[model samples]
Target: MQPLTKLLHFGYQQALSSLFPVIIFLTLAGTKAIQVPGLPRYDLILLVCVMAQIIMVKTGLETKDELKVITLFHIFGLVLELYKVHMGSWAYPDFAYSKIAGVPLYSGFMYASVASYMVQAWRRLDLMIVRWPHAYWTIPLGALIYINFFSHHFVYDIRWVLTGALFVIFLRTMVYFTVDHERFKMPLTLSFFLIGFFIWIAENISTLLDGYRYPNQGDTWELVHIGKISSWFLLVVVSFIIVAQLKRVKGEGFANQPVPHAKDRNM
Candidate 1:
């Protein structure tokens, strides 16, 4: 197939794959087959994920680096999610519909795929913010996003939150060292990965500790416990070392150096 056709095909597959989870949840809701906790109506998370993917596919503005960054983020997210489930940080109400391993296939796989699109949207918007740097809008926008998590329909996972926070710190350190030593300038890809890592940790931690778990319904707190938290930390440190080495090898010849008033087409 031609390159353009191939990209279109990939986009279609990604869109359908990402939307599958939302479709399943809606169908389940209609038939009353499964009822998720902390969720009153249909699966809004699934809807948001699907919508984000659709918007990106329609825009046709994605670059190879953006795709690479998003793909890696989702891969890392899935790995962390599998760990969360194994640790019993959270439990699914319906075992029958569980997809991959223990996770609903849609939730485990499709939802993650959808997250890539969401990250891309955030990147595009982030660029605009970087350009405009409006304190008035940024603070309010950040608060709005944070507040939305408290709503009844939105369940925060505590274990993920803690893990995510550590990840963000790790990424921030990576960025600071890279820029400080003139090894490599921070790019959106690196920033997004750091943001995603932190988010994943934060969301899981929030839900596991303070957020709600449903169906089996109990008032007792699960308490924060992650045997693998140290493992994740080690991984982040190792990843930073590797990325730093790679950056050094590429040196100043690497084309992604930061430029003012200019967007990185590679991204």
Candidate 2:
């Protein structure tokens, strides 16, 4: 493909992969500004999320296995939300029947959307890993990254430590993705940071729409701290490791898979 054609194809695939998240963002913006008679904003958003999931599956936009992974992300994200809210890391001050421990159920879908993007992009771009660290390295690292999210509240924050470790672990790793007939590659760690940065941008948009509030935003909305990008970066790593490792176990890792055929290429 020519340079311009390749860029267009890549952009189209990215937009397609992000369809679910775009819907969620639109729902957030819409619900915040428009209200129904009795339904809470959070409750309305939750309903839309549920309906969107069903519609995606029914329309074959998401596979059953992909939905299962996204659901796992929801559960994991909700647990993190519960703990973070209790710790005063953030607050959901809005009223809603769906609120549990001050968190609206729809919050989990934010995290699930990340997994959804990963799965969709993986399939659409035919992503593959090169020099992925062994399970022994990745599993423990993923666990520590997740644990540190909660443990940092009680102990010294070792996020920078873990961040450094991420560099060392993935230093040689590359992600190969197809843009068209040609293939392209990026440092896997760079992809992690990029995804995290974009999610941080989305987080700002979500907060601006009253999706949730940080402690600093209690009085008025301001831009989310740039430091939150580090958090999202680590979270992205954990999400990627889970999805990538599962693919490996299912015998779909890059080694066993053939280069995608032309007819099979969606981009």
Candidate 3:
């Protein structure tokens, strides 16, 4: 009972940090029905997102270290964006002065939003993982997964092999999160799938909000393919590997502050 309650609170914190951008995008998407502004919708949203990021830091909602993680995602996401857009993957369907290579600047923020949730949830929920693989293995696998995203177009896709590798590497790993004085545990690989599934759902919503257009969607709204789950699953793993670089172990003399009675959830 206690663990469930804490998990809910942790989720609430995560939703606040991550979903704010989606909420804003959805709300402003309605403005297309009636507009009085000379600025394009994409530019306006980009401006608001930039301000929102600054405000989060100024208000102390995000720590400097966390901001660094989020910024890293932005840069990495932009690089992926340039490659994906060039390769005729999903695309932005609107006009924006902020456009480059047919990708709007705001597109990168979509990935940063995920990073914000990861860092915020790590702090808010006091997260840790057990039996985490050594960096030697995780880092190389992450690099390969990231590269496959670009190379799949020219070379044959190896995501199937990578998916199997995740299972092998994380087979014994469990993620732990503290909800108040208690802890709960779940398999790390499962969490990867869950996060990926949710991100895929958000992708559908984003496209409906005019975030981007996929090859088959044509100018009309359509549900994003369920098959994309596999892609997002691997992508989420990449995100996790980057975030794990922080080494945010919560207890056993790792964190700066003591987390009282907050041990691994298996108990």
Candidate 4:
């Protein structure tokens, strides 16, 4: 099948899967036994899933290596998030629903899928930097956008900090290894550092916009602030470097292609 066709198919399949949780939620919501107040309705989950699926399909599925990395990160995040909930590091103000293994399956799946889409988008856009001058700015800009909109909840639910920290560490270590091994060497680590710095700024802005006053509350900064910035920078830089290296390799390979003999070519 054509790549575009495959993308469409994958997207529809994912979109359907995303709605599964909503269906389950609706069934349970009808029951008086399940009390879920002020819970962002399952409709939100459906919307998230639909949007994420569209993004993923548009971007293309993540490469196998990227998928592996994402899976591990998701697993690690899930574990930490579960631990935080258990330890009272954070509490869901709305619904009280625990699924398999004492974690909400729908929430876990949604988060993981979103993370996967992020990785996929990054990979698909990997070559853009080469095509456009100063395209690297998008890395930081996108991070800033996401942090501004999405990070306030982190402050409200500090348990995410533990999971977020773990994710940062995992990403950092992965990027470090990629850089050290010269797998995909980026020439502009400085750009990534800037992006990370901007992410921190965005997060701070998000907090203020949310009317949150945090004076080192829950020690979130103490644990993950610096590390998160560092990791974001490293990940972006390494991703760029890898793309750069891959392009170079591809160019070299094409250049080294053997000339066809006239007789052989005709044959």
Between prediction 1 and prediction 2, the one with superior lDDT is: 2
Model 3, runs deviating above 4 Å: 1-8, 27-36, 248-267
Clash number for every model?
A: 28, 0, 0, 3
Q: Tens digits of per-residue lDDT for model 3 on 1-267?
A: 865787687767667657545545664576556554798888877787888878888888878878888889989999999889888898877788999988888778888888888777777766766677787889999999999999899899999999999899989887777666577678889889998998898888877766788998886789999999999999889998888866544232133333345555453
- Judged by lDDT, which candidate is best? 2
Best by TM-score: 2
Extract clashing residue pairs from model 2.
none
lDDT tens digits, residues 154-178, model 4? 5552324433433343332212111
Model 1 lDDT at residue 40: 33
For residues 175-227, write the lDDT of model 1, one tens digit per residue: 21111112223443355455346544543543443222422334664533454
lDDT of each: 0.40, 0.91, 0.79, 0.39
- Screening candidate 3 with a backbone cut-off below 3 angstroms (N, C-alpha, C), the clashing residue pairs are none
What ordering of candidates by lDDT runs from best to worst?
A: 2, 3, 1, 4
The sequence of per-residue lDDT tens digits that candidate 2 reaches over residues 110-192 is 99999999999999988878788889999999999999999998999999999999899989887778887677777889999
TM per candidate? 0.36, 0.95, 0.89, 0.34
Off by over 4 Å in 1: 1-44, 60-65, 87-89, 94-98, 106-267
Give lDDT: candidate 4, residue 56: 44
Residue 219, candidate 3: Cα error in Å is 3.0
**How should the candidates be ordered by TM-score, best one leading?**
2, 3, 1, 4
